[model samples]
Target: MATKEPSFEEQLAQLQQIVNQLEQGNTPLEEALEQFQTGIKLAKSLQNKLTSAEKTLGHLIDDAGNERVYENNTDDPSNNGGGNRGFGSGDSVKG
Candidate 1:
């Protein structure tokens, strides 16, 4: 059976342990190399997760509790709702 992939926290914890072990300099060269590779993979996975989260969090919401994606143009006149608009801003900002 295939092994389950670790969650983000688990992966981060494993990566930390790997770093600690490698830093101790007690592992044999070959074993240390393998740990290093594993750590790199974990790091990449964590990074990708973080990137995905940032994109998700960056999504702007409209006044009616609807999600509105931010476009490349920050100065778009259509989006000028001041600080009261988007995300968790109060209902007063609703257009």
Candidate 2:
């Protein structure tokens, strides 16, 4: 049987574990490369999920009566939508 895709949280947890393993620097070069590739894929998936959520939610309201629209500035270098931030980035989901 085919394995089910992991949930976002599970994927993020796995990505975090991969990051920790990669950071250890003890893995063989070949294995490290594979892990790095997996990290890249996971990062992309997480980013896409966030982008979708932003589109679905429309906008957000801050605690101080501030309304903010979800805008994705892909051109912004500071936008950690990709590998910019360490693995495991997304909005929290409660089951």
Candidate 3:
């Protein structure tokens, strides 16, 4: 099945609409419960998509158009906190 490609705003709006409809309190108990389940699924799917997208796109950039990629050197014996990880005030930046 093809998942809908909805922007964050659009998904949020749909979620709100579902909430509003459920909140009106006029639907039958069975229908209300079904709507609630659908809303929960929508919320979970939206959350997961947003989180994955964030992780995929998360990054730091410099004024010189350099991408900052940080690698932990904890396993290296030379890295003993003797410096500030060579990152500060854009002087010693990442990447």
Ranking of all candidate structures by their lDDT, best first: 1, 2, 3
User: Which segments of candidate 2 are over 4 A away from where they belong?
Assistant: 59-95
Give the C-alpha lDDT of model 1: 0.81
User: Residue 20 of candidate 2: its Cα lDDT?
Assistant: 100
Model 1: lowest-lDDT 10 consecutive positions: 72-81
- Local distance difference test, each candidate: 0.81, 0.79, 0.72
Expressed as tens digits, the lDDT of each residue in 1-95 for candidate 2 is 99998888998999999999999999999999999999999999998897687555756889998878655435444553332344345545578
RMSD (Cα, Å) of candidate 3? 10.7
Instruction: Kindly provide the TM-score of model 3 when superposed on the true structure, using C-alpha atoms.
Output: 0.53
How far in Å is the alpha carbon of 2 misplaced in model 2?
A: 5.4
Model 2: pairs clashing at backbone N, Cα or C within 3 Å: none
* Model 1, span 1-95: residue lDDT tens: 99998899999999999999999999999999999999999999999997677567657988899987663334344554233467665645646
lDDT score of residue 51 within candidate 2: 69
Which candidate tops TM-score? 1
TM-score to true structure, per model: 0.65, 0.60, 0.53
Considering summed lDDT, which 10 consecutive residues are worst modelled in model 2?
A: 80-89
Question: What lDDT does candidate 3 reach at residue 61?
Answer: 78
Q: Flag regions of model 1 displaced more than 4 Å.
A: 1-3, 63-66, 69-95
